[model samples]
Target: MNTSRRTFLKQSSFALAGVSLLSNRLFAAAAASNEITGIQLYSVRDDMKKDPSGTLKQLADMGYKYVEHANYVNGKFYGYAPVDFKKLLDDLGLKMYSGHTVMNKQDWDEAKNDFTDKWKQTVADAAIVGQQYVISPWLDESMRNNMSDFKRYMDVFNKCGELCKKSGMKFGYHNHNFEFSTKLDGVRLYDLILKNTDPDLVAQQLDMGNMYEAGGIAMDVVKQYPGRFELMHVKDEIKSKNPGEMGGGYESTVLGKGVIPVKEVIDYGRNKGGTTQFIIEQESYQDKTPLECAKEDLRIMKGWGY
Candidate 1:
């Protein structure tokens, strides 16, 4: 083992003696609280298209206890009826803790009456599948590239958060690289959105790897806005040693092989804020098959001794 890996293991053994390791496929006895290690389904989207049900079962077998969904185009969740999907998930011993489906203001305006209707239906589906969060993952073109856009965007966010609150679900935002690079009114657009939105009304699904890629420090964001980030994406970025500008126009690497400060960020998120889950997302694979890449990631996390 490398020196860092050995050091990490030694420390974990000394300090986190009873904590279950996330590396191995074995279940930690201390997971009495039902804590989860989830995967963003987007990682295996192609495989899912080929065989959604079978792929889900395979993911469970591969040690992913939970999943965050990506493809719920219409009222239906994952192309199947919600009830049916729920049963399938239950049979697989998996829980859909969150989803990345977006709803825009125009969508709500044209179907304003349908707003509550659609919202109710989505929340009902979440309940059916045991999902706790429904996240808006992107900013439309109109909401980007300028200052005025962010101001308007915050209003929409607050409104959506209120709607989600009333429906017994949490509303969250999942960011991409643009939110970091794009400036709004001399300040970062992300800062404006977080400041303007009600903390209780809106939460953040802080993609730690992407946040680092966006030129924002993950620990700093969490420190500045405590409790707002209930969920976190735990991926690593392989830094380009050449020292060009990092983030925004950035590239991703396999988990645990990036320049991103993985341990410090997770430690900060877990101890400093309300971090609910540390999700693993692998987007880069230059040398291996998808399954090989995922298995390597699992092995790396296991090596971390957590």
Candidate 2:
């Protein structure tokens, strides 16, 4: 859909890196046992950009306890240093459980056989801000076109997972429309990624709505890869009036107010897909303001007993 956060990741100089692997058993055991409902801050991108503090307060007041960030630049999260941001969220009874940062070739040094310091710093800051997962939201176009390089980057994704394990966090990948439609050697790109990465280290945060544009069905994916998804971008889709970047004639809308079988698919995810975190994300709000949509989304999720 070419979201604002997606554009930021493309332009920002912030990079990602990895370190040695560690046992994830302990970390996994420490994961939140109860279901968590959070909002991807990108749902209110303009509000966050204008007044991060005020936006956060509004979210907290709406009864949101968790958030998933989409901006981290220059060792800061939305202009606040990691520790400061954590404190700000804590004060408002909110916690950032996950964040999106694009990890590309620049983050990895082939010669050194390791990630650059800049990426290591990204993970470090994620830990400081109490993030349970550091998710790379986009797969660069270059990496996807070549089979060899694509598989190589999948290995890097696992390496990042190992790196995050040392800090009691898990490394994750969030999908766009490409993974479902793109193929290599006749194999779907999404299948290759799931095969290459270790489940204990790397996690999948399925964006239920993003893939609709690519002819992906959330129910089919969950059934095909049961127990693989640990996180989910809870969303609903509808036929778009102004279709552009988001192809397949679809756009995001309020929960359960669209064509997607939102509740049915998410219920399946909970019972079979191993999804514990349901993070709400609505990119196109129809005629409603983003904040209005956010509030309604939270209310709907609660009503559905999330």
Candidate 3:
């Protein structure tokens, strides 16, 4: 989004466009593996920025076998090249199953009828890091405010799914509070997303806690869209002391310590919503260290039989 980054991507477009795609069969085998419980690295953003290797080692030591990344910049994950980062995780006994990278309009080249080189490199890097899914965590406001544009972007989302499919990966969208609160033509934006995208290609990763502030109930949503969500952001929310942290008077807390029916909802997500990956993510620690919160969340999830 920045000027420098844009220029860099343009300069590297040709080289990255040629990156090879992985085999669909290999990706299918990976997808067929047992369910996973992972942590989103963004929960410890400061620590990762300071010492990615040390932070990862600590997570592995805490019984975390899998992780989902929230940081990727200029074709690198946490400052490490994709292959090198994969090796680091391999050595630490961890696997990165998914990651967040916002795929905005800039990533698409309408003139070429294809993705820009930068996005292609992003997918290439994700494959190199052995990820099953490449998720975009945010939707730009321009795409949301207009009905015609929103529908067009939804089409683009499906096209992205097609691109990811060729590389043995699935393109996924992660939701936030806006999707639940914002509506167009009397239809909720979230519903439009679910309706527009093809299920086989575009997987959904629902953030359970995010929708609460916007009056969206996790239980109802899962029941409404049975067998739609393939992944879930396992989080709990409590009334925030400081309001408006996430455009609502709520912030994430450690699992089982907040108002969310953590157990019941995830149970439904697994049994009825088709969720296979339960990823722990707590954004606010309430005086506890981020790592401490991370440890407790994992313990709680395991106790619940995840």
Please list the C-alpha lDDT of all candidates, in the order they appear: 0.72, 0.89, 0.91
**TM-score for each prediction?**
0.79, 0.88, 0.89
lDDT of 3 by residue, 217-274 (tens): 9999999999899999999998887884476889999999889998999888776577
Model 2: per-residue lDDT, tens digit, 217-300?
888999999989999999998888777236777889899888889898888877657788999999888889999999999999
Name the regions of candidate 2 deviating beyond 4 angstroms. Answer: 1-32
Could you tell me which residue pairs clash in candidate 2?
A: 17-119
For candidate 3, report its TM-score.
0.89
Candidate 3 has its poorest 10 consecutive residues by lDDT at 19-28
lDDT score, candidate 2: 0.89
Ranking by TM-score: 3, 2, 1
